[model samples]
Target: MHAMTLRLSPGDDLRAALDHAFRTHALSAAYVLQGIGSLSVARLRYAGRDDAAELRGDIEILTLAGTLSAQGPHLHMSIADADGRVVGGHVAPGCIVRTTAELVIAHLPGERYTREHDAATGFAELVIRAS
Candidate 1:
């Protein structure tokens, strides 16, 4: 596993910047180690939910983890508002960075990742081939 440290700028958007990083690094797959930062405006959609709810206030990212694929990332995050009210959900499109987000990403071998249809789940999922 190769690790990289990333620093998000004040005006940088979280997912957007990460997407750029993937492209720049030519990464086929990666995972967020953990993220710690603040967000002035956060938009999160928890799994099993149809839509995202907008959060407008000071918030801190508690836990951030996800998978980066060719299709995109399937990220989830837990955040707390100014009052320490915590909420977690599926990462949506509107999670804007406030001050900065310091995070680490680990890249996996490109050939190790493959997709195949699964009858049980009825979807194309990651299938790690044996080395």
Candidate 2:
């Protein structure tokens, strides 16, 4: 396994940065080890919602973790607003950084990963390849 650290700058889209890493590194399988930072805008899809809710403000990222693949990342994040109200959900695109975002990703060289629609879950879920 190998690891990488990324620092996102102001105006950088959170999801886009991570997606670029997945493609640029050619990671067959990877996971978001940790993520911390701040954002000016957060696009999050609440539970059982098809669309995302946009929260605009100075938000501090509390938690960010999930699986990553070439197909896309199934990431979840929690952020605290300026008033200290916490909100979190499935991370979507258009999450713009206000200051910086520091992230750690673990790359698994021996594993192959993919996402496929599952009838049971009604969502495209992770499929782990055998080592």
Candidate with the greatest lDDT versus the true structure? 2
Instruction: Give, for candidate 2, the lowest lDDT window spanning 10 residues.
Output: 122-131
Give the whole-model CA lDDT for all candidates, comma-separated.
Answer: 0.81, 0.94
Candidate 1, residues 58-124, lDDT tens digits: the string is 8899998887666566678999999999999988876888898988999886444445689998867
Screening candidate 2 with a backbone cut-off below 3 angstroms (N, C-alpha, C), the clashing residue pairs are none
Best by TM-score: 2
Error of 1 at 88 (Å): 0.3
Give residue 14's lDDT in candidate 1 (0 to 100).
83
Give the per-residue Cα lDDT of candidate 2 at 17.
93
Give one digit per residue, the lDDT tens place, for model 2 in 10-77: 99999989999999988899999999999999999999899999999899999999998878888999
